[model samples]
Every structure is written in C-alpha cells, then in structure tokens.
Target: MTALSELNDDVVRSMSIGAVFSDFDGKINCLDFHRTADLLVTSSDDDSVRFYDIATARLVKTTYHKKHGADRICFTHHPSSIICSSKHNPDSNGEFLRYLSMYDNRCLRYFKGHKERVVSLCMSPVNDGFMSGSLDHTVRMWDLRVNACQGIMHLQGRPTVAYDQQGLVFAASMEGGVIKLFDSRSYDKGPFDTFLVGGDTAEICDIKFSNDGKSMLLTTTNNTVYLLDAYHGEKKCGFSMDTSPTATIEATFTPDGQYVLSGSGDGNLHAWNISDEPNKVGSWDSYIGVVSCLRWAPRRVMFAAAAASVLTFWIPNDAKSEPGAPNPEG
Candidate 1:
C-alpha cells in the first residue's frame, strides 16, 4: 500500500470494502488519521473516543467522557495525546475544548473562550499548534504548550479552518462563501488574500487544502463541494453531493490531490476525478446507513466511511491483501 503506483484513478475506482467496525453505540461525529502512524482516532456522540490500528484493522482503545461528551477529535503529535471538543449542550454550558492523554486518562488542559460548541478542529501539519472553528462566530489558534488561546479571529459567521500541507499558512471559510488565507507566523496581520466559493450562498461546513497546496476544497451546507485553485482563487470544478441534513458530510482529497471522495446520505461512497473536469468516477452503494464521516488515509492506499455506528474501510481490490488488509507486500 506504500507504493506510489497504487495511487491512481483506476485503483480508486476498483476500491471496495476492506474492513468494517460496529463498536460505536451512537453516531460517530469525526475521525482523523495520524500523520505518520498506523492509527485512526474517532469521536462520537456516545461520549467515547476510540483508537483503531489501521495497519492491523483492530480497535486498540476506547475512553469515555461522561461529563462533557466528545464530538470532534485530532491527534496532537504524540500518539497518546489528543484534543477533543465537547458535545454538551452549547447553550447551557459555554463550550470548552479539552486536551487529554488517553493512555492515562488524564486531562492536561482545557481551552476556553468560544461561546458555542466547536464544530471543526485541525492539527497543524508541522507542530503542536492547531486550529478550531466554532458555532460562536470565531476561529481560535492554540499551542499545546500553553493554556491560553494564542490567536482569535472574529468572523461574521460560522467558520471552518485548515492548514496547508507545509503548515506555513492556513485557510478559513466563513459566511458568504468568503475564504481567507493567512500567514501562519503572523496571522494577526490578517489574511493576505480572500477568495469566494464559486458564488455559493450556503454556509461552509468544512475546508481542506490539498497536499501540494495547489487546490482548496469547500464543502457547504447546501450539498455542493467545490475544488478551487488555491493560489488564484479560481473554481476548477464543483460536485453536487447527495448528503443528508442529519449528517455532516466531509469530503477529502487523495494524498496526491488528483481525486476527491465523500460519503452520502444514500449510503453511497462517491468519488470524482479532479485532475481535469471533475467527473464522477465511481459511486459504490453497498453501505446500509447514511454515511456521515469520511476520511482518506494520509499515507496508505485506504479511505474510511462511517454510518450511524458502523465504519467501513476501503482499499483497491487489485492489491495483494484486500479486505481488512495490512500494508501490501511489494
């Protein structure tokens, strides 16, 4: 699976279910793969955070938060540490994010400020610095070493944030289809440039930057996913997704950035070949429930999709080891 040749449209088109997990008792809210590890972490409405060894296809650990509940999660460099956003009622208890060491079940710190629950969280590509976007109309930056939020941006609407592959810059998508790019080191100076998302009027649900930093992805509440030229702010293509309001759909770029994939309300996994015109390359419809969360493995030839409580892992069928596969032998 490490071989670069495995990364291709033909291979992705041939991809199918390789593994499935049914351990979750509630809806899975989000999942993330470790940058250089064989691990995948997920946060759910069940108030639990679970870790799966993607290379081994097994659940390694599960921890619960009975007090606050867990929704969004991201690894903080160390495999044992993570940052989790609370799933508690946003109105009653102003939302605060918790940084914890799962190995010992110890709380390390709590990041407080936002008046509403955080909806998006991303770990910086290069360091302990990270970003969180909330329903409170603000995006805040924090460093793992400190307890205070390092920076905050008062946006006009709900926001989503992402860092480029190099982590030298980050992008924020807010109300009115506005996309703002900032220099990571001196973000307070403000965005260097602002781009709009193909004139769409929907609120952006999430934003992602391609590994090469050449493409930007915008997933809006209106079920439209757009791929834009990161530098020039030109729309390269737009795909109308079939997602449900009950689930927050997330679209991802392949590691090579040549394709985009997402799960839909119809329980189908959809992919588009974006090297050019962005045509639908495939739509596998085997899933039984509304596929809500989806993510592409950072380095492996795999992608995972989740429904209410089941998570399905997919891999190219042509590979030596297919279903529930380990890294294929070259």
Candidate 2:
C-alpha cells in the first residue's frame, strides 16, 4: 500500500498502513503524532507549521515559522504544547534565531537565543523544561511554565539533544565526537560528564534513549548507527547501511523496545530485530527521497516515517504479511 509519487527532486512520497495522507511536496520537514489524540503536527520549509486530524486526514491549522521552513519540530508530552526550530541562518550568527517557538492555542511564545540555527529540539520528560542544540555551540534549556530562557551549557560544538529514561540529558556534539550527559536537576550546580564514542567524525544527527533507557542508539551524519550502554558508556554494537549518508537521520526504538527503526537519506525505512538476533530485520522503500523523521505507535502496533513530502505507516509482519504492508524488498 505504498502511495507512489514523485514529489520533487528533494522530496519523495510512499504509503504505509495507518497513514491516511502523505505530502510529497517537501512542505513538511518534521512531524510528530500526539500520543493520545488523533492528531499529527508538522513543521515545514515554507515558514509554516500545521496540525492535521489523522482520523479525517485533513489540515486543521497552520502556524507561521516567521522565517524560512523549520528544520525540526516536536510536541511536548504535555499534550497541549509544541516546540519547533529552523535551520541556522549563517547571516544571523545563529543568534536571535527565529528558532525555538511554542504553541498551545491559549498562548504562543518564541524563544530568542542561540545565535545559530537551532538544529535539534526536544522536551524534557520529567519536567516542563525544553532543550535545544544549535550551530552556535551550546545547549540551552527553557522553562515553559515559568517562561524563562536558561543560558548555555558548553558542549564545545554543535550538538544534538537526547534524554534517557531517568531524565539525564545527552548532548552529542559535531566536533567532540562525544555524548555529554547532564542530570536534568544538576543544571547550575556543577560540571557535567561527556560520553565519547571513538572513531566517528561526522556530526551526530540524532540520539535516542532506549525503551528502558538502559541504552541509547546514536546516528551520525556519515550513516553510522551504534548502540551504547547508557550508564557505562560502553559500546554495544555498531551497524551501517549501503545507502547514502542521508538515511541515518534518526534511530528510534519500537514502543515495546523490542525493535529498532531508522530513516535513511536514501529514502527507505530500515527496521531491525532488537531481540531476535542483532541485525536480522526488514526494510521498506516506497518513499521518493530521504526519510527524515520517524515515530513509533504502540497502540496501533505500527510506526510512522516522514520524508520531505510524504508519510508512511509501518506494521510488523510474520510469515503472512499484513494486508497493507508491502513485502520487504531487502
């Protein structure tokens, strides 16, 4: 059931089971599914953000990004709020970025900081704080409840933000090749520790905490993925794909944490068995371009992947594939 279409040179469209609609026009850069609501929110390149009714497959509302399209967007666990940012505009020195915006219908606020483009964004699970990483070489936390913008903690280079189950923060940098950990409660108290993964150079695009938060999966710009112990910082396993460097945009664990799924620049979603073996799994290649964002839906027993334009819903298969799931080509 892959919706087949050519959105653009930079975008692709593919189909999957639970997805009602897919936009292949590069209108959306990043998207997230609300945990309890039948809604989907997307941040796009056209300086606009949109909300969609998943059940009806229709756009609900659009919020202006104010500049160019946003590079990323995320919904707060609060269920009523959202946070988003755009790519660093070199002319702005990465400061005063129109990046870092939040919305809740009752109120909307834009965070002013980060001299460079804010490439990474996330909300803290244990608290009301939000974190962002930028090309300006810092990670900052914001308290939405208090409306305060906390200043930077030096990660020494551009970093990506990931949080573990215990609420500790991980900041993986572009220059240091290490992952920095900070206790969500330890800010302003003292120094934080960094976890270095040797032998990798390209910028870390994204890092995710495993289901139990015992381990984390790291993705680099060079299309490399590694599983590392969350506590000891020891390496668990490393894997790479034959596709272009783009496919490794994000790596996430299944809702049950029994499987791992990653989106690639080569326009495919690779699902691997976390418990069955290590590398044995399946892949879906219906999108036209890079699969930029991915999220798992446990209640539906499926996951979703978004490229520049389209979105696809994926379901696991047994010997008899499900009705909507196309057989794996790899």
Identify the leading candidate in terms of TM-score: 1
For each candidate in turn, the TM-score is: 0.94, 0.78
In candidate 1, clashing pairs total: 1
**RMSD to true structure for each model, in Å:** 2.8, 7.1
How many clashes in each structure? 1, 15
The residue pairs that clash in candidate 1, if any, are 18-324
- In candidate 2, how many Å is residue 319 off? 15
Tens digit of per-residue lDDT, candidate 1, span 88-160:
8544445478899989998998887888889889999898899999988899999988988899999988898
Write candidate 2's Cα lDDT for 132-236 as tens digits.
887778788887655457757766666788666556654445574687676677766643766788887767778888757777788877777788777788887
- Model 2 regions lying over 4 Å from their true place: 1-20, 24-27, 35-38, 53-59, 66-68, 87-107, 166-174, 189-193, 243-248, 316-330
Q: Model 2: which ten-residue window has the lowest total lDDT?
A: 4-13
Give me candidate 2's TM-score against the actual structure: 0.78
